[model samples]
Target chain A: MSAIAIGLTGVTKSYGDKVVVDRLSFTVASGECFGLLGPNGVGKSTIARMVLGMASADAGNITVLGEPVPGRARLARMRIGVVPQFDNLDLEFTVRENLLVFGRYFGMSAHQIEAVTPSLLEFARLENKTNARVAELSGGMKRRLTIARALINDPQLLVMDEPTTGLDPHARHLIWERLRSLLARGKTILLTTHFMEEAERLCDRLCVLEQGRKIAEGRPHTLIDEQIGCQVIEIYGGNPHELGALIRPYAQRIDVSGETLFCYAPDPERVRGQLRGHTGLRFLQRPPNLEDVFLRLTGREMKD
Target chain B: MWGRYAAALPANAWNWIAVWRRNYLAWRKVALASVLGNAAEPMSSLFGLGLGLGAMLGRVDGTSYIAFLAAGMVATSAMISATFETIHAAFARMHHQRTWEAVLCTQLTLGDILLGEVAWAASKAFLAGAAITIVAAILGYAAWPSILYALPAIALTGLTFASLAMVVAALSPSYDYFVFYQTLVLTPMLFLSGAVFPVTQLPDAFQQVGRFLPLAHSIDLIRPAMLGRPAGSVGLHIGVICMYAVLPFFLSAALFRRRLMR
Candidate 1:
């Protein structure tokens, strides 16, 4: 087999009595995109931190860039870039200055850093924002600029934690397009996000975790196929609390939420009869998707 | 492997240089205030206490008050540099900028980053001391040979305090802790550490007690050097100053490492 860019064995982490990442093992091959799928509070960020050497694991081993990950991991961290969940951009510095300063952290000369900055700005579509202070940029602009900053070192492995979060649909798709383009060029990427659609669109393979434990693992389509089947019948109106009594006889599982009920079954069409006599109800059927699979694995209840 | 580590020093230094640039711009008001405030305290003390008290008191070990106060002022500048650098500037880097965290993400280790910070802060402290000394000389209060030794003496004090302040910053959970140190620790030490009055003026217990404080030893080294007088007992002073310099750095490095590990 060819070399793996990242390798891990039973990596574990905990805070006080609360375990954040529990005995997890996985690896990302060189020149491939790997998605880390998990619900909020499932230790996805914890794993990412361990990989970055930001946090040391309480147990187990890992290797990154052919070295023991987070231990003897000698690959210059300057050769890796991280897009944190929250923007840590220097507000005082202009977009270009931010990149320049970050480059200096790796000992890059001013001449070397400046020469590469323009192309990174253009790649993130923020070329016009070269002189603008980071604080003046909008959220989408900031995110894009962060992506550009991540590429300044020409990183071998890029780690993104919730990159598209808190963005409009147009911005999200633009990010997706940029990410796909990166993958096409054969860069190794590790991604973590709350949005399932992003994972389905970008990940080659993913593992889902909940409360610090791995719950499911596979490609998005395969996980959806195994957990949520091919069809879903969504019913809205009526007292959703009574949905179990109304739809349980016909559906495989009845998920009562707010004024809507999710009837997850092998055939959505066959479940329409259970709701036929129901009063004050509207219903629709759609194909199975990554969102359904995620909700099923992590529960559809409101998460604060 | 060590080549990469060595290469990262300049990288780490660059981060501090960038921070220094931004800090100078963002806190220009504070910098101007530091320049003025740092200079003013010494000058005013020289005029008020040194001149006023010296006219009445006659002499300290037989030197006039204006002359005596100028020597004290040189020591004061060292204290001010250490105070401003360790408390105000260091606090902002830890709390506002999160500058160290960003720098550590590179190939640079924590040790290089600390050294860079200490270097920059020490440079600033030395500048303030040198500026005050120039003013003292213009007023004809300085002795030339003592002035020659003033730089090394004050520079050491600057490192001592910068390292000490870094420990304070690394260990403190908030900016309030810095204020607490300035008031409770730094202020008393400044007055009691032989800056204004000679430790000889104090009672017997206070005189011997003075030897233990890092600032006292720093004062012992800086004052006599600025006055062209012999610095008493070189070995003890250097030993005490070096202790002041190294202890806090070890503590701060350990603390920073603990925080980063989390």
Candidate 2:
């Protein structure tokens, strides 16, 4: 079997009365891109911190790179690189300087860092930005620079938490592309994001987290097939309650709008025949995806 | 483990130059500012106390008042600066900058990092003391060739305080605790350690109390050199200074590793 880059079983973490991760159990295999998906306030960052060995778990075991955590984690950390959610790039240094210093922290020699720095710059698509002071760079440039720093160790397992957060569209896509390149290099990736499209595009397999628990886990397409059905039709043009009432007979699951209704079934087209007598009904049918799974699990409890 | 880390470092002479070059590039302004700010306190004391108050105190230890105060102030400034360097900057690195979090993650051990920090703070303290001596030169202190002795004396003083500061740093919860150390420990030592008056002036009980602090031996070793004279107890002074050196060095390393290291 390929190396297991990360593993956790019966892992629990808490803050005062709040149990953030309750007996959390999971693992990510080497050379795979795994996603940890959750909405806001869902302890995703807390889980990421624990994986990085920056925070203590209240109970249970955590292993990375085939070794028991904390003790083995020290060795594993040197081999694994982490791109934290916030961009804490050393503002005192230039973009290249940031990478250079990070390499220094790992005790990378000057020439070795020199050799790796250029490739990292190219990977982040900020080769032209090597000389710029980190403070002078734009938000996206700084974010990419932080990712470049994480790669200086050539980590076998790359853990990135919300790596593209607060970036422009172009910057976000650039970061996504860079992440994909790392994936192609046979690097194991553990990534967390709130964006469904990102999860769909990158993760080979994923786990959905809600309220400090794993709600579901599977590949994107399989998750969509099993977690949500063929399609969801949301009708918003008419009285949603009445529309919900009218569509209830046709849908396996009918969700209401004030004036329109969603007819969810394998054959949503059969809704046309069923709705033939109804007039001025409007709706849109879209494919099932992570977002639907997310909503179906979360139940819109004020994401906060 | 260390070998694996060093294997990756720049093996060439150019690489060492670059590491220090970057340190200088990033910190030169800080160096200049620190040197001036550290020297200024002694300068103000030289004018206010050495010149102003010395007019009444007259001769001390057979040297002019300004000259006597200058050498003592040199030791005081070095200790004070070194203390602040490790306490303020190093603790900030640990807690605020999260710098140490990034540092210890690498190939470097707790020992190497502690050594580097001690060396850095000590070197900065040496510069501060050197700056005060320049002011001593303009004031016509008898010491001239004594610059050689000044080097190790100031370094000893630096090591003592730097180690003490590191211990404080390991325990410090915030900047306020450092200010407390200054008020309670550093400030008292400056006035009590014979920085101006000789230790003999204090009571027998107080003088013996002063014997335990590192600065007492520090001033004992420094005064003769700055007076441009020689005294007995070279062996005793050297031994005490070495204790000052070895004790804090080991303690700082051990404490820093225990407190900050994983």
By DockQ, the best candidate is: 1
Each prediction's total of clashing residue pairs, residues at least 3 apart in sequence or on different chains, is 2, 11
Candidate 2 CAPRI classification by DockQ: incorrect
Off by over 4 Å in 2: A235-246, A254-264, A267-284, A299-304, B1-25, B104-115, B134-147, B167-177, B202-209, B228-262
lDDT of 1 by residue, A1-304 (tens): 2468777789889999999888898888887778888778788888887787767788898777865555543253756777888777878778988898777666678899999998898889998889998889998888988888788778888888999999999988999999998898777899998788899999988888888777787878888888877577888877766765756666777665667777776766667776677788888788888877777777874221
Model 1 chain B worst lDDT run, 10 consecutive residues: B3-12
Best-performing candidate as measured by TM-score: 1
TM-score (second chain) of model 2:
0.87
Compute DockQ for each candidate against the true complex.
0.40, 0.22
Q: In candidate 1, what are the lDDT values of residues B187-235, reduced to their tens digit? A: 8787678777777788888777777888888777776776778888877
Q: Candidate 1, after superposition: displacement of residue B91 in Å?
A: 3.0
